[model samples]
Target chain A: MAALGFGLAYAGFLGLCLAMDRHHAELLRGRPAAGRRWLLRGVGWLLLGLSLLPCLALWGVGIGIVAWLGLLTVAAYSLVHLIPYAPRLALWLGPLLPLAGLALSLAPT
Target chain B: MKQGFRQCMAWLHTWSGLLVGWILFAVFLTGTASYFRGEISDWMRPELHAPAAGGEPAILAIETLKRLAPDSPTWFVFPPGERNSELRVVWRNPPGKPTPPGSRGFGNMVLDPATGEPVTARESYGGEFFYRFHFQLHMPPLWGRWVVGFCAMMMLVAIISGVITHRRIFADFFTFRPGKGAGRSWLDAHNALAVLALPYHLMITYTGLITLMLMYMPWGVQAVYKGDRGGFQAEVFGVAPPVRRANQPAPLAPVGPLLEEAMRRWGGPPGRIEVQQPGDASAIIRLTRRDSEQISSNPQTLTFDGVRGTLLGASGEPGAAAATRGVAYGLHLGRFASPLVRALFVLSGLAGTAMVATGLVLWAAKQRHRHARAGRAGFGLRLVEALNLGTIAGLPTAMLGYFWANRLLPLHLADRADWEVYCFFLLWGLAALQALFWPGLRSWATQFAAAALLGLLLPVLNLLTTHRHLGVSLPAGDWAMAGTDLLVAAFGLLLGLLSWRLFRRAGRAPVTRPVRGAGLARAEGA
Candidate 1:
């Protein structure tokens, strides 16, 4: 559950960062087009907001916030490093990683 | 004095950070490890590696107390938990019957819950040494606290100044070009780490200061309580002050009912019980709930008359200021967190340590660049280089050496714990000497390589000295033991990788001149 929360939070943060003009230009081909930026921003907020659910469910309000922030930092840090060489991987990671995390979290221990 | 605000802050940040960076690095590293203090202590005392059980801890505690110190005025029992397997009991004489002022008279032992027999683990400070050294630096208690308090002030100033000094904090968080020039790489790392965990760094530093605030800024308490620190504590925490013993003897009531009553009232298990004047008519039994169960780290207590088992009422709820202070302390200590939260706390702490380390390296690297332009990397740069290597890698090597000494030293050795500590400092001193002789690249790589070797060999050494290897521990489902070995080996592997990378990086041409490029401008200016 914690891992899932961390993953979602991380992915959501990266999505927001990737939506930014600077990071988008650096990590992807050219700038994010207008529609794509809006879509990225919308999806980013949704994922970021939704990220709170698993954490709140697992660890409650106070600790959930703490865990979510930590996950965001960890995820952003890894993504920052990944952008230099594996831009494609970093780009896809923001959208797909959370799904994998959710699936893994739902599976039995 | 005539500088702009940001310039002043930059000056403050650079100098304040450099002056105490070495001490802060040690503080941050040891404080980070202290998050896993219980687990580390468990790893140190390998003989007590029994699986945690579901037995009644209070009953086991009572049994031990009866056998050990039945007539003692006070007793403290730390029950076995999910991560802790040993049942520790300590008994002490009542307050006001002082051998000396501010002195505690107590005897403690760790016992196995199954057999109620004392578990004679090897005499070593274990994780406690790291925890103590973080704040105390192995000095006398008062002096150590003052020193740590002063350093903490410097740290708080550095963080605030650092925040103001950075113009593009958010942008810096997303940028770290590792293979850049030495100065740029170190600055990037320092900025990235500091900005990435900005909230944690700020909160941890502020709360760390708060934890020692009463000593540092005592005027409020002094004015309010007329210099009676105990009175201030009793008032703020809502606990009774120690009472004069009524020497008259009376049959003490059984503590089981009192414990159960307190638990029922508090809606949590009692973590400890203290019986004041246990054999007398004035005996008072205080039941303290575990701090782990509350957001507030303050352990709330319920007092009862010991002879009749009648409630003497509970301590009043803390006021807003006190409660806020308590929560701050809680966040700093993080004793209330679960395993996952605790792990994140450790991670953030490591980031904080790395931030300090990279800052130190950035200073040295920049100075080296300046001195290189002048023909020789001067004494100041060399000294900083040597000190950086001495602290960053040398401390961990000494810690691992302490673990090795625990297993290698004879059990019958006199002052065994002290000897373990001596070995730690002695090895650390040797590493510093090696760093002084080797300087820069060789110093960093060699110490890391040595540390890597020790870390890599830790489990093997454990397996040889004690039969509890990862092979035995993992298969037996002993996660604590298994986890310790795996983590140590993983850290060893990380150290090895770092050493190899530094060696390679050093072999490459030293980038003396700053590269002229668009994004590289700040790198040159810094």
Candidate 2:
């Protein structure tokens, strides 16, 4: 559940980063159009909101909110460090992490 | 006026941060390590390798305490739980009896719950030293706490002023240019570290002050209780009044069923059991709910009549003010957090430490340029540089030295715990002396290299001196032992890289970039 939350946060931050001019230029090698930027921003906030579900499910409302905030920080820190050095790997991990988390959750203990 | 306001905030941020940066670094680093305090202590006591036994720990602990200190007025029994592997019991000496040597009027022992026998581990403070030093700083209790509290206040001021002073916090949120020139690189690193964990930094600093609020601001308590501190404590913390002994001797009822009942009520095992006047007709037993089971440091205790094994009372839910205080205290301690959340706390702590380190170095780097242009280093800049070197690199060396002393010191040595602490300060003092003599990049490199050596060699020393090395522990699934070794080695690798970088930088040409009013530029940039 924590991994799923972390993955969604990472992916959400990635979307927000791509919406910015500087990061988008560095990672995508082109400037994002106005419509594309707005679309990215909307999706980013949506994904971040969606990420709260796993945390709320894992812990109750009180602690889950705190855990979600911490997970967001971790995800953002990872993205900030990786975007500079390993942008492709940073992007790849977003999808891969959630898939891995899903497989682990479904597996028999 | 706007510009003047920001400049004033910039000055406040710089001075506030620099004044207490070194102590803040130490506090942050040690506090981070304390998240794994139980694991570190377990690793230090290698003789107690077996997992907690299936039998009732409270029963075993009570049986041992019955034999060990039968006449004592009070007994504190901490039964083996998730964090600890042995049942620990402490008993206060009865009146008119000579206190046990080295025990300070109390007798304590670590008992293997499986057999109810004492485990003969070497005397060491282990992770308790870091946990204590985190807030108290190893000084006399009142003095250390006051100094740390002052620094925490300064840190809070710095954080708020820093946010106000920063011109482009969001724009530079994800920016980090390590390969840039010294001033720019350090500033970027500091900003990134501080910003990344900004929420954690704020929460930790605020809660740290709240933890020791009574000491810092006693007026409220004094005004309310009129010097009756005990009354305030009893009311706020739900501490039951002390019971007088009946003098008539009586066999205490079995504790197993009582423990089971308490556990059933709390939905978790009790963290501590307090037996007052044990074996006496007026005996009282209080069981405290484990910290891990709730997000409040305020304990929920159930009191039982020890002789009859009947429930006396349970502490009711705390009032609004007390509950708020309890949650704040709980958030600061992070005891209720899961392993994953605890890891996040540790990471945020490290980020805070690094933020302080970079901020200090940034000040030195900015000042050195001005001093170079003036053709001589001033006394103040030199002093700050030396102190920064001694604390940043020296403290880790001392911590590792303490761990080494735990392994190398003989088991039967008198006051072995004190000796371990002395070894820590001895190493730290040596580093400070060396830095005082040579406060330069070379000195920084040397100290970091030494720390790297000590950290890397610890696991090897453990293997030579004890059976609980990585080789044995990893295969046996003893993560407490194996994790400590691996974590130290990882830190060793990091310090090694840092030392190599400084050494390489020192070997190169003196990179004296042109100073365009470096101090003003920094004030403006910050």
Candidate 3:
């Protein structure tokens, strides 16, 4: 049950993070293309909803999501590092990796 | 003071963080492991490896107390429960040393829960040592605690100053560029980790200070109560009860029933047993922690009259002052939380450790790149590099040595655990010496390998020295032993990998370009 909650939360978290990373990248690299703006914004806000309650609860399930999120982010990070042309992974997964890492640590193993 | 807030904070953050970084790192690492301190103690001592049943803890406490402190002035028995297996009973029998008996008191561990016999659980002062050392370190007991209290205060200041120093706080959110010229990466890591759980950092630091605030500002009680520590304690928080002198000697009242009552009241097992006198005229018994709301699980003591063991009214909690203090301490310590929250704390702790490591490395990298650009890494740069290597690797090497001493030292030997701990410092001292002599890549690699090798082989070392092994331990559900072995293996693997990587990284030519990209350069002036 904790794992499920953690997963749902992390899934949304990851999606949101992806959009944020893109937004960050666009700023750093100068400007973002016009049409793609909504994708990340919509996803990021949606992820917040998934995480909103569980984070407040700060229970096993919440930590589980956070942990799974960390693992996923690590995976996404590895993908970014290992696979060229997957800059998109960084765009999406970068923020979540660290945030999830922090959240996962909210409970003891 | 003369400078702007940003400049002053920058100075404060750097000095404070650097000065305390080494010790703080050690504290964080040990504290993280302390979650499994009991398990470590269990693994360190193979004979008493079973998870003793909790149903009989109260019984064990009663028995231990009856035997150990039949006529002590006071008794402090740590009741056995889910958290720890050992049955420890402490008392103050004073004449020579008038002060708090502190560490020196009659102490024994109930070896086996099944047999109700004293099993030889190799005199390991391993787990609690770190817990004590975490705050007080190895200095003079009370003074050490005060020192730790002060550092915690400074840490709070540093954290605040760091936040102020970093102007682009929100702008540079989620920034880290790996393999950057070390300085930039260090700053990024420092910012990232510090900011990631900024609230946690601040809370921990603040509460840590608050926990020992009494010692730091002893003048508050001292001035008000005119040096009456006890009176101040009773007045301020009402946790520590007042001492009563008994004129007439009476048989010590039975504690088993009181504990039972407290347990009935509190709902959970009575976590601890506090008796004013072992077998005296004035012996007040306070039984606490049976059942309480999750909001505040303070050791709700059910005090008893000294002579009759008659239940006294439930009292204390100086109008929410003590309760406030407790909640702050509990939340910071994670003692009140469910197991899951503790797990999160541990994860964050590990990440925090990583954060420090990354930051330290970044500092070195920045210095190196700067030196390289200047075409000469000077004497000072060289010295800083050596000091970093020495402290970072030396501390762990010392820890490994401590474990080895625990197993190798004879049980009959006096002050065995003390020696074991001393060996850690001794080894750490040697590491510093070695760093000075070598002053290069070779020393780092060698010491790291040495630490890792020892850590990885810790289980094997235990097996060879004692009858404990994986086969016997695993099936028996001796998670302590199994966990210790697994942790050792993990450390070994990590160290081994690090050693290899260090070797690989050493071979690569230094890069002149700052490693900033991927949002790491947000705040830095280009």
Number of clashing pairs per prediction, in order? 0, 0, 26
Over B247-355, each residue of candidate 3 has an lDDT whose tens digit, in order, gives 5678777666776677677666666677776567777877666321343444566788756778976756546777777667665565533555555566666666665
Kindly list the interface RMSD, in angstroms, of each predicted candidate in the order they appear: 1.6, 1.2, 6.2
Worst 10 residues of 1 chain B by lDDT: B514-523
Worst 10 residues of 2 chain A by lDDT: A97-106
lDDT of 2 at B212: 93
What DockQ, on C-alphas, does every prediction get?
0.56, 0.63, 0.14
Query: Model 2: what is its DockQ?
Result: 0.63
The predicted structure with the larger DockQ, 1 or 2, is 2
Candidate numbers sorted by lDDT from highest down: 2, 1, 3
Off by over 4 Å in 2: A106-108, B52-54, B100-104, B511-526
What TM-score does structure 3 among the candidates reach? 0.81
Q: How well is each residue in B1-526 modelled by candidate 1, as lDDT tens digits?
A: 5359889999999999999999999999889888867777888888885744545666667667766776677777776666666678888854445554443577778888666678888888888899999998999989998988888899999999998899888665577676676477678888888988888898888988898898889998888888999888877888888656788888777777887787788776677777677677888878888776666766588888978989997877888888889778888887754777777787899899999998987887677666555656566666777788789989988878887888899987998989999999999999888777755564577788988998899899989988788889989977667777887787789889988876665555354342211111123333
For each candidate, give its TM-score against the true structure.
Answer: 0.91, 0.94, 0.81
DockQ-based class of model 1: medium
Q: Report fnat, model 1.
A: 0.41
Q: Give a tens-digit lDDT track for model 2, residues A1-109.
A: 8878888888888888888899888888899999999999898888899889988998888678778888888888888888778988987886787778677666787
